[model samples]
Target: MTEKPRMDVHDLVSEIYARDSRRVFSTLVRLLGDFDLAEEALHEAFAVAVEQWQHYGVPDNPRAWLVSTGRFKAIDALRRRVHSQDVREQVSKRLDELSQVNAERAAREIEDDRLRLVFTCCHPALSSEAQVAMTLREVCGLSTEQIAVAFLSAPATIAQRIVRAKSKIRDAKIPFDVPSVQEFPQRLESVLSVIYLVFNEGYSASSGESLTRADLSSEAIRLGRLVMELLPDPEVLGLLALMLLHESRRAARATPEGDIVLLEDQDRRRWNRTQIQEGKELVERALASRRFGVYTIQAAISAVHADAPGTAATDWGQIVALYDILLRSAPSPVVELNRAVAVAMRDGPAAGLSLVDNILERGDLAGYHLAHAARADLCRRLGRTTDAQAAYERALELAQQEPERRFLKKRLAEVV
Candidate 1:
């Protein structure tokens, strides 16, 4: 047998940062009882790991090591600060409790810390807008830029919202406990939206070398299952079904080398029938309830595509109807862009181009790359080469993900 390659300590730490930084941060929040303090401790622990791990070698349990180190760092910081008599005594008491809690793992949080953290961030104390921004920024590890893209707002605005949310949590001393079962309904919408946005980031990474991040999408699906099990509501079922149906296409979504395979171009034989069937069943149940939301309607649209054996067989008319319903329910520029694409399939390029132009003229999705890419495709189909080239160029400029950028370049080249 060949010898196993030795991994660099730095690379290992970086990999762990990508995978478990948020996880460790969540646990640290539980241990230290403050988001800002926990965040600082997390970075300090990782920095120390880089220098120390080289000499000590990789620990058998890196996460545990990081957590322990973070806790020590926080305690040291607290010790360094001078406080009033009452404040000092309170700090001493809290530190004693922290040490006791660390020794007794059974006393610690039994629930998934991320789940608890998400619910905590979604507390009614924060506004709905702040809740989404805070969870996406803190819990999901999304950049403020990514959160802004999801919200179609300015990055600075999203950043301020997150800052304000964290300050409120700290000032109010919000209990980070997982919300009770009854409180799930009140916070369910915000939680579901955040999960789906996480799924979106994974399904189509907003930026990065890879087109998809399987870990993020898988976690989103897992959360969806947990939510459905606890809530068993129509919208929850609908959201889960929507993710499953989209995930079912993952295998056929890209080439082995990681180039994107557009939905119409992807090979149907590679689709996961099991997920498709399960998603379709859930969608049916959710639709039957008539209480399903936009997610259910979107899943119904995906079900229409799943039933088709090929792109040509896809019932675009039915999809357009679903889009119409979805637009009425949600009414976002993104939804309108999607519906315009569907209308192109049902009618002709000219018809879809007209709708897209109307949307653009209204100053909606002006900065969204996908909107330009869709416009490019429609223009290309209509033999409007100049318009296609300009649209493709705009998309290429705005696109971040490498695979998508490559695809745009290829389309731009074709027109040139």
Candidate 2:
């Protein structure tokens, strides 16, 4: 067996940070009873870890050690604040509350602290975007820039959303715990939405040089699994199935050189059949319940595509039908755009082009790069070179991801 190289204390501590920082943070959040303070404690603990671990070697339980250190750091800060007359009473009360909460915290459920944190971050008191932003920032440990790239929004915008979310939580003093069974239904949508967005960003990065953020997607999948274990809701199963099905194509979604690979051109042999099978099984389970929603229907569409031998053999009719149901249930412009692409395959490019025109005429998805790219593809297939060129140019203009931009530019060149 090959021996692993010994890392310096600094490097080892950094590795520990990458692995256990979020777990430590979660425990500290439960102990400190405040997000900002918990965050501060997390960093302080890490800074202490680098020095302490070097002098005493690594601890047998790094997470527990860090959690202990972080809680003390928070306590120290709280104590210091207690001496300030301006906020003495307020700080003293907070310290008492923390002490009591921490005492009862373990008996309640310390192991599920991260899950509780997710629910708290996804609280209904916040806006949809704020809920998503906060969960990604805190639970997933994604950076502000990373979240911004996934959302295709400006970093400043994402940062401000997160700031506002934290302010709301602080000002309102939202509890750092999971919702009750009755409260689950109300908070479920935001939670699911946050996970879905995370998966989408990881599955196909919205921007950046790389085509995929595998780490982020894997985290989302883990979160999905965790949520399913807790709730097993039909929609949750559907979402999990949808993500697995889509993720199954990860190997074939791009060239080894990191260029984009259109679904029709991807090598089916390279697909993860195991994930496909599991995803299909999940879809069946969700469908059997007769209570599934858009995600389940979407997974059904993915299953049809997965089962196909090739593009020509795909069940475009089934896909279009599923999209129809999704549209009726959700009724969004993006869904209509997708349905149009399916129609183009099931019917003809001309029929699909008509739908695309109608959507564009209504000023829907005008800023969406995929909508333009879809139109460009239909136009190209229909031999409408002029229209294809224009659509591809528009898509290229809007595309932020390097791979997508390259693909659109290539399409534009071919049409021209």
Candidate 3:
């Protein structure tokens, strides 16, 4: 047999690491019961894999192998720490007990580890920002640099936040299991918010050359599916449905040259039929439950768009109604801005423009680029060329993503 190329070995190992790193990390978190220690063990296991897998060839079960290796690494690190002998003995004893579990049981436990990790990261004890940062880093497998870029903050600041969040988790002794049914509803909202934040960043990146970060969006969808499977709450289902409905249009959300394509202009043929079908079904299920919340209403609105044959055929009135309901449940300037857009489609450009102007006068979303961009679009539609030009200029100055800036500049040229 021909010898396998060395570069192929490196590529294969990298692929394995990318694919199984989060799973391995989740399992290690369960075994170690300390976020920092589990993270250290996970990296150490991969380092060992680089040396061992190259010589011994890949393991049949890479996730299991990594988990076991990480456990051993954690035990070794514990022994090295200058703590009481009792502490060392306790960890050693736990490792010994874990080692005796049958492979079948261990595999089952590993399957549930990701869910536990999600709940732990979204614990109410942590602040909302910290919960989001921790979930993005630990569950979504994003680097601090990537998270910082998403947050528009320095990497050091993001790093410090993650460190503080992890330290809090350890110090607070947050349990590594799903919250009880009574405690779950309050906790679940935070978990869903973090997942949506991840998806939004992926669906329309805040700053970068590309408009979409498919990797981040896809990772969010994967986590959404995992959460839905583990806990079939109505809102959880709604959240997954909402993401799926939006993601179905990913292919058509931008032009080949990477310019933004407004939803009304996007090619319906490019939308993922399978995802739309699934999302619509999920929306129905959520709505029928009557226990559905904000996410379900948003999914219903997306369903309306998806069901329409074209923009002219869209049920804008229904969308506006849904937005009204959404606003009542989760009132925010952003939701109000979206509602204004829907109101424009339902009523007229003048109606939408009036709402946008009111929002601007209130000075709530004055610095928000999208608010300015929306105003510019409305101004252009109403033949207010000078106002449109100024608004576009403001949007261009505020926009950070290259694609968005390019889009704003293109709009500005048309008005000028």
Candidate 4:
């Protein structure tokens, strides 16, 4: 059989960014001397790449080409903005100097630029939300629209957040370099959360045709791996494991027509055994450390799912026990709701209904779709078709993702 040439779009995109991301980002940072402007310039450079790559072919040194192009574009932009003769001259002189940079210096400069960008995006000056938005947009190459969707906010709001975050970083004079080991722990949680958000967005896309956003999930995993390589913490290991185990079920999470598949009904044969094995190893390692966090606990839950051969074979009692521990560690309405599901599986639907009713009565999850979905399921099981239909309608209204909404609507149809 003849071998067919294959081009991996994901790897191609990653390589293009990796090679140019630092140098181009640095050029913009140096040229505009602002994180926001540098980020904008980098976006502009990639836009041009998308346009030119079809005809020109990817350059031998695509990174260098992007850096050079972005630099000139930024210089032109700066020239247009500056009316002052002195400022123009300063910009021109800096441009000329950067153009004449030596090879060794360029390497060092690019490294400095990347390091500066990473720390700047994660600066203590910005709020955690802003830091996450800025880092995903600037460093991770996600569009503002994509970011806004991920954050469940308006695009304009996300844009403003990024702009404000950049301004804060500049005004606060946040150091461009990576923090020392002594300062790592203080900033670690924010970084981990951002990575976790990335994985989640992929696991269930905020708005997309597909059930799983593999790119976002893979990017999160990649970033997680990078962080673990740089600093191996138990929590980081746990997060990586969690993402992997969830991702392993991607193939079985939806039907051929793209309808949602509940975990119980998903074909176990379709799951990625390799990812399951890898995630299990990570969980075991994390448990051995005895220094696990919320991510580890969540990973442990996923590990239980992976261990079970089938839905009927699952240890619901063990799952309920884990949820109890999780409730103590992370007292969230979502955790409680999940516990209710486990209770239904272990004890009975009536018991689960009581738990869900208690949560809903408190108005803690007034707009959460899953809460309604859980109620609908329990009501349906108890032969309360009218109540089940109402609950499903509520779920459909609150559901953000199309697939989830469709799933709820289908459930409503089944009862009505």
Residue 265 displacement in candidate 4 (angstroms): 0.9
Q: Model 4: which residue pairs collide?
A: none
Model 2, which residues run further than 4 Å from truth?
1-24, 39-73, 85-88, 91-108, 124-133, 142-164, 180-183
The alpha-carbon deviation from the true structure for residue 16 of candidate 2, after best TM-score superposition, in angstroms, is 9.7
Better of 1 and 2 by TM-score: 2
Q: Write the per-residue lDDT of candidate 4 for residues 55-145, one digit (tens) a residue.
A: 5566665666677667667767777888888988887787777667542335556655655565667777788778778777776667899
Clashes of 4: 0
Cα lDDT listed for each candidate? 0.84, 0.85, 0.86, 0.80
Q: For residues 1-416, could you state the per-residue lDDT of candidate 3 as single tens digits? A: 22445557678768878877887888888777788898899999889977877777777777787888888888788778838888778867877876775433366577688889899888888887888788889987889999887666799998998999988877878788988889878889889988898899889877778788777788789889988977888998899999999999999999889899989899999999999999999999999999999999999999999999898889999999999999999999999999999888888889999999999999999999999999999889899999999999998889999999988998898889
lDDT of 2 by residue, 1-416 (tens): 12223457788788888876877777788777788899999999999978777667777667777887888798898877675686778777767776665433442254578777888888888887898788778876889998877666899999999889888887898888878888877678779988898898788876788889887788789889877876789999999999999999999999988998888999999999999999999999999999998889999999999999999999999899899899888999999998999999989999999999899889979999899998888988989899898999888889999988888887788889
Separate clash counts for every candidate? 0, 0, 0, 0
The stretch of ten residues in a row with the least summed lDDT in candidate 2 is: 101-110
TM-score of 4: 0.73
Q: List the residue pairs that clash in candidate 1.
A: none
Candidate 2 pairs with clashing backbones: none
